[model samples]
Target: MSNDDAYDNSGHIPDAASYPPRWEAEALAFRHALGPRAVTNWSYGDNVRQVFDLFMPEDPPKGLMVFIHGGYWRRFEPGIWSAFAQGGLDAGWAVVMPGYTLAPEARISRITREIVQALSFMAETVPGPIRLSGHSAGGHLVARMLCGDAMLPAAVAARIEGCVPISPLGDLRPLIDTAMNADLGLTEREAAGESPTLLGRGLDVPVTVWVGGAERPAFVDQARGLAAAWGAPCEIVEGRHHFDVIDDLKDRDSALMRAILG
Candidate 1:
């Protein structure tokens, strides 16, 4: 195997090819069920991909839960992950899944900023505290928001009650040598600058770094490194791998929901 193979989650998992079609079907059914409550294509920027899908709970929302989809910053969109918002929605929170320009089109730095814009818009549209959660590269984006360089409004920053970056890529330096960097287009400088691990202390909010015990060792190290940098809690769920680790996003009673909704 190649040196960068350690970052390859799909290759490590059997039947990985089935995940996309499954997600698409589940997300479609979820949107169909929500009907009007699932607000689609709310734009935060002029770009088509800058839009987000919001899923509101039946009762008044407890707050907002933003789940950013992760595909190494170069794949997937908000709609495909709609089903994942059910956990937050079930918890009486308005859940949002934002789409940003992917790598090869927009730099990771810009994607990070776009999420900030998405959160700011969500803050204006939804009242109450904000909870941030993302899987993989998306986890990197949510963590980036807490960095001072993100420049979130004091009010918006203050409302962020917690962040859970699941199986996150906390550091980017290693990617420079990986094969995906061709599409990621990350220079050494860009990787270092974009790494949440190298950035200064984040906003004063609760943080949890969660990874699957069965995930790639590199990912486990990334979670540990991130938690160490922020002095936060790190959760390693046994028997779970990268793809299945975020499944709890659709379950209200799951530990993931308690961390996000609390």
Candidate 2:
């Protein structure tokens, strides 16, 4: 079997089937708990998918923290991730979660651009230092935002305080021949272009890579490799899986939240 086959996560994580209903339940509960303070369907682009929701703290915000949801650039919704905003909100930081058009319908490159647009919009609207965090493919997108060739303006790029790519897909080349790439439609050029590990080293902003200790080997390797390549620190959350690792973001005092703040 190829490295692509070996690194394929859907094949390795059995609990992948449970994410939606579980996330949906949490999202619904968050809506009930927060009420109108959780703003929904704020448009960033003309497309219906280019929308984001914002969760604000009662007091003035310290900064903006954007959490990008992961579905391998294919599935998941921002609504399902609204509950994760609790930590940032409690920290006196405003949290934004943006939704994007999924793969097959939109290429990875375009999705990257969409995220840039979302961040740019948020940067203009929020007007403060920004911290980015994401899980799985969303982690890939967060890391991609730091790429040297990224489309963000010089001023906007400077506003990026740090990034936390949780359980990120740092190296996309491994997915070219994997089952995961079918919908991603990644070519050699696209994979290399999107892969943060291949994008050079020592970024201007600090980065922290987070991965679940109980996650698949490929995910561990991706997190470790990206940290080593960029000279960033990698935090392994012991006993957490691909899904459970991100749950730490919901706890304001958790290491994951601290990392995001840093």
Off by over 4 Å in 2: 2-15, 201-203
lDDT of each: 0.91, 0.88
Evaluated with TM-score, which candidate comes out highest?
Answer: 1
Q: Taking the tens digit of each residue's C-alpha lDDT, what string does model 1 give over 152-197?
A: 9899999999999999998999888889888988898999899898
What's the lDDT for candidate 2? 0.88
Candidate 2 per-residue lDDT, tens place, 93-207, comes to 9999999998889999999999989998888878789999999989999999998877788778889999999999899887887776789898999898889988954348889
lDDT of 2 at 100: 97
Cα deviation in Å at residue 18, candidate 2? 2.5
TM-score of 2: 0.95
